[model samples]
Target: MKYPVTVYGDPLLRKKAKAIEKDHPKLDEIIENMWETMYYSDGVGLAAPQVGLSIRLFVIDASSGADEEPELEGFKKVFINPEIIETKGDEWTMNEGCLSLPEIREDVSRHDEVTIKYLDENFVEHTETYKGFAGRVIQHEYDHLEGILFVDYLSPLRKRLLKGKLIAISKGKVRPHYRIKVPK
Candidate 1:
């Protein structure tokens, strides 16, 4: 089932998520629901906090295209209690946005490549190396688990410029339209 995504400035978004202790009865169902919610919302990634859950879980599928492609495929992957064990290369700037902070996009500097160790939906441990846009998406979602937002990477001036919008979002003065369907 699709769930409501918490908007920016929600206090829950700032609280660090708690780690999932074990594979419990509803863990699989929760993860599945998260994936459905994410795809329904047209998001590349979504964290538990975004859905009002304070668990260290996030889902991502960064296999979308840059521009030219006519269609994008979902390579959905789940990360439960993920950690970036290593990073390499200089920071690269990419235009980034989030489901929590809607209608806002900014250029943020992030590591071009990263090696992350994480548990999958089945609770199996795995490690993977990612680069380019895929890597950036992973890092961004990872930050959500730690109570961090991409806007935090902005300079004081940039952040200040966006203050009004952020405040409006937090106060529910403005609502964002979530594109919930993916083109087949």
Candidate 2:
């Protein structure tokens, strides 16, 4: 089932998520639901908090059902309790959007490469490095687990300019293509 994405202004998005145990119940089902919800929303990545859950779990499919990036083709995976071990490389700016913060895209600066340690859906541990679009997608989703939104990386002036739009989103004034759970 596709879960209603938690929208901006939800307090849950500000709280850091708890790491799930290796044998957490219904882990498989939750992962499957996340995939369904993400694909249904046309999102490249998604986090648990975005679905009203406070768990350190997320899914990413940088391919986005397209062949835009040959390197990202078939690059889909589930990250459970992920931790960034290292981030090395020049920072690059990319236009980023979030499922929670609809209709607000920003050029955010991020490292071009990242090395992360995380678990698969079955709790198998792995450490890997990613670059280019895949790295950007992973970093973006990983930030959600730490209660960091892409908007937070914007400059104060830029944020001030977007303050009204952000508030509108919080008040459920924005309309996204997919289902969202606006904060009450």
lDDT of 1 at 90: 88
* Candidate 1 error regions (>4 Å): 66-74, 179-184
lDDT by residue for model 1 (1-184), tens: 8878888877778898998967555887888888888887788899999888899999887667535332225556889889999888889998998888878899999998899999987788999997777788889998999999999999999999999998777776665565322111
Candidate 2 per-residue lDDT over residues 1-184, each given as its tens digit = 9999998899999999999997888888999999999999989899999999999999998876346668777889999999999998999998999999999999999999999999998789999999989999899999999999999999999999999998998898988888889899
The candidate that achieves the highest TM-score relative to the unseen native structure? 2
Model 1 per-residue lDDT at 4: 80
Model 1 / residue 14 / CA error / Å: 1.2
What overall lDDT, based on C-alpha atoms, would model 1 receive against the true structure? 0.82
RMSD of each: 5.1, 1.3
- Global lDDT of each model? 0.82, 0.92
Per-residue lDDT, model 2, residue 53, is 93
